[model samples]
Structures are given as C-alpha cells and as structure tokens.
Target chain A: QQQVKQSPQSLIVQKGGISIINCAYENTAFDYFPWYQQFPGKGPALLIAIRPDVSEKKEGRFTISFNKSAKQFSLHIMDSQPGDSATYFCAATENSGYSTLTFGKGTMLLVSP
Target chain B: DAGVTQSPTHLIKTRGQQVTLRCSPKSGHDTVSWYQQALGQGPQFIFQYYEEEERQRGNFPDRFSGHQFPNYSSELNVNALLLGDSALYLCASSLTPGKPQHFGDGTRLSIL
Candidate 1:
C-alpha cells in the first residue's frame, strides 16, 4: 500500500511534441504527489507537484494531472525538447507521519531533436 | 543559500567494512533525509533527521544507522556492508514538512 507504480520504463518523443508519463499509487494515506527529473550522475530535482484536493497543477511547460479517486497521477511536458530528456520519477507522501516519500520505479524519457 | 551537499562524491568498500556518508543541509533547512538509489531504480527512503534526532526510518536493517549534529549536518553509517549495498546515496533537505525536497548530487558507494 506504500508503493507508487510508474509506467513507460522508457519513452522516445520528438522535439516540439508532447511527452506523457503515468503513475498509479496504492496507499490512500498519501496526500501529496510530486514528479522529479534527473539527468545522468545527478540527483533528482523537483519538477512539479500536486495535492488530492486539486486535479491538476501546472508550472511552466510541466503539468501534473492527478486523480484522487483512481489513486493515479501523470506528468505532461509540452513542447518536449532534447534538454528535457531525462529520467522522471513520480512519488507521494502523506501529510502526517514521518513525511517520507514513496517513489515509483522511474521512467526514462528521451526527446529526439 | 547552498543546497544539500554530500561528501566524498564516491567511495569503495569491501565486505565486512563500514562506510560513512556526510550531508550538509541547505541553509535555513532543519530537516535532512537520506535515500538509496540502486541502478535503474528510484531513490528509496532510508531515514530522516530533525532537531538532531532521528524522527523516522525505513525498512533498512539495524546495520544502517545515522546521526545529526546540532548544526543540522547529518551522517549515514552502514556497518558490515555487502556487495548488494553498492548504490548511490542521496541526501535531500526541506524547509518544512510536506514541502518539496532539494537533493544533492549524491555519493556513489561501490562495494566489493
């Protein structure tokens, strides 16, 4: 019940296109959802985040579409560029408790120019 | 303000050896969390420290322990290590609970 399941282990998208990655979670205690982006040999960086109260949140060209009822969430990158190619991870954390994050396996997105 | 910073960048150890990784949290941040990221896998929570005490821990064994100083610096110690322990150790810091965390480059541990 603490795991976040992310899909599309790897994806290839063309430049100026849209890239999407999906994640489903099992733990209902989670109230916070976030997406992270990582380049080679670098730590994961916070891309965007959302809460159960809101269905969607956008930052720049990145957006998080959340489904509280379905326990699912996804990340959409508009105008995907080569620099956007990186490993993306979806994660969740409960409002209370230790505030530890539960992360999915990860998705490697490759944008071809 | 400086973000989370980890020391040694990389380390190598053999079986039965012990390793210690250090972390300096971002300025004005009081919480520090440690994670282990195996190849092709996302970072897994190890533990968290606040106010110089370990507030929470994950599923790791007792061989994995930690300490936090009054200055908000933290250390992760792994004893009796095995080859399977090889992975990237990441340090993340946040200003408040439920807020986004900032990560350091990470310390790569290679066990032989």
Candidate 2:
C-alpha cells in the first residue's frame, strides 16, 4: 500500500508564477512531513518541512501548509524561477521506533522563462 | 564536513552475477540507510544500519544484504542479480534514524 499519495505527476508554470504540489497520507500517526528537491545527476536536498503541531510553515520562497484533520499537506513556491525546475518528493514519518519515512511518487515541476 | 559519499558512480552486471556498493557517511554521522529508485519512481527503502548493526529493514528479499563497519561506513551487496534489479542505489546518512537525512549522488547499477 502506498502510504503517501501525491497529485499532478507533472506540472509546468511560467516564471514568477506560483507553483503548487499536493500530498495526502494514510497513516494518522505521521508527525513529520518534509519535502525534497532533486536535480539531475545529484542527490535530493531538503527543501522545507512541517510538523503536525503547526498548520503552516514558511521559509523564504518555500511554504508548507498542512492540515492535520485532513491528513493533507501542500508545498507552494512563491515567485517560481526557471532554476526551480526539478523533481519534488513529499515524505512522512511517524517519529517513533526506527522512523522510516514513507515517500510519495515525485512530481516533476518545470518553470518556463 | 563531507556529505554522504558513494563510490563506483556507475556499474553494469549481467544476470546471475553479483554487485557491491559502498558508502561513507558525513562527518559525525553514525547511521546509514539504503534506498533503491527506479525510473520515474520515488525511492524505496531497503534497510538502515547503526553501530555496525542492522536496525530496520523494508519489504525486500533475502538477496539484499548489508554490513556496517566500525567506522560507520556501510556496504550493500546484491546476489544473483536480475534485470529487474537495475536502478539507482542511494545512500543517506543521518545523526539519528528519525532525523533529516543527507544523501549522496548515488550509484547507477545496470543489470543485463
């Protein structure tokens, strides 16, 4: 079973536009949610993360909005740039035991000039 | 201050052969985790190691095994490789099992 589900396998947006990616989780025990950005030929880098206690967390151009009751979270990039084009993955962890993170299928975002 | 490092960035093997990949964790990190990513798919967890012991594992086969050394470096060995085993093998390091993980560039393994 896929613990996490992501929408819009691929997305394209104009420069300076807002880019959005959505994700939902099946495990209510998940407490940590993190997003990662990966470029070609490189490893994934941490972008932004949010815990269950917070409804929203923002860092510069990246923001993560989470809904606890709905078990959903979304990542919004403000002023999206061409360099922001990459694959994004959303993951969740239960915060106990071994803390294995269940990831969703990545969403490829392309920003045009 | 070095990040996670994986060796043999690329490799090719035929069916029934075996392959091994290595990883060195970042400075001060003691935990290592392995993941397998196929084309257009998210990474699937293989297993994790800490203190030279296997801590947790995912739903994989017995053909996949690993070893962690005293220095905290790790190795992944696959026996009797098959065509379906071709994928990018990634190694991640973290201070603890539940914390943010730092990843390496990964080793691409192609099985014919």
Write down the C-alpha DockQ for each prediction: 0.68, 0.67
Per-residue lDDT value at B81 in model 2: 97
- Identify the candidate with maximal TM-score: 2
DockQ of predicted candidate 1: 0.68
Q: lDDT score, residue B70, model 1? A: 91
Docking class of 1: medium
In the predicted model 2, the residue pairs found to clash are none
Top model by lDDT, which number?
Answer: 2
The reply for model 1, stretches above 4 Å from the true place, is: A96-98
Q: Give one clash count per candidate, in the order shown.
A: 0, 0
For the record, the alpha-carbon RMSD of candidate 1 to the native fold, in angstroms, is: 1.2
Q: List the global CA lDDT of all models.
A: 0.92, 0.93
**Which ten contiguous residues of candidate 1 chain B have the minimum total lDDT?**
B93-102
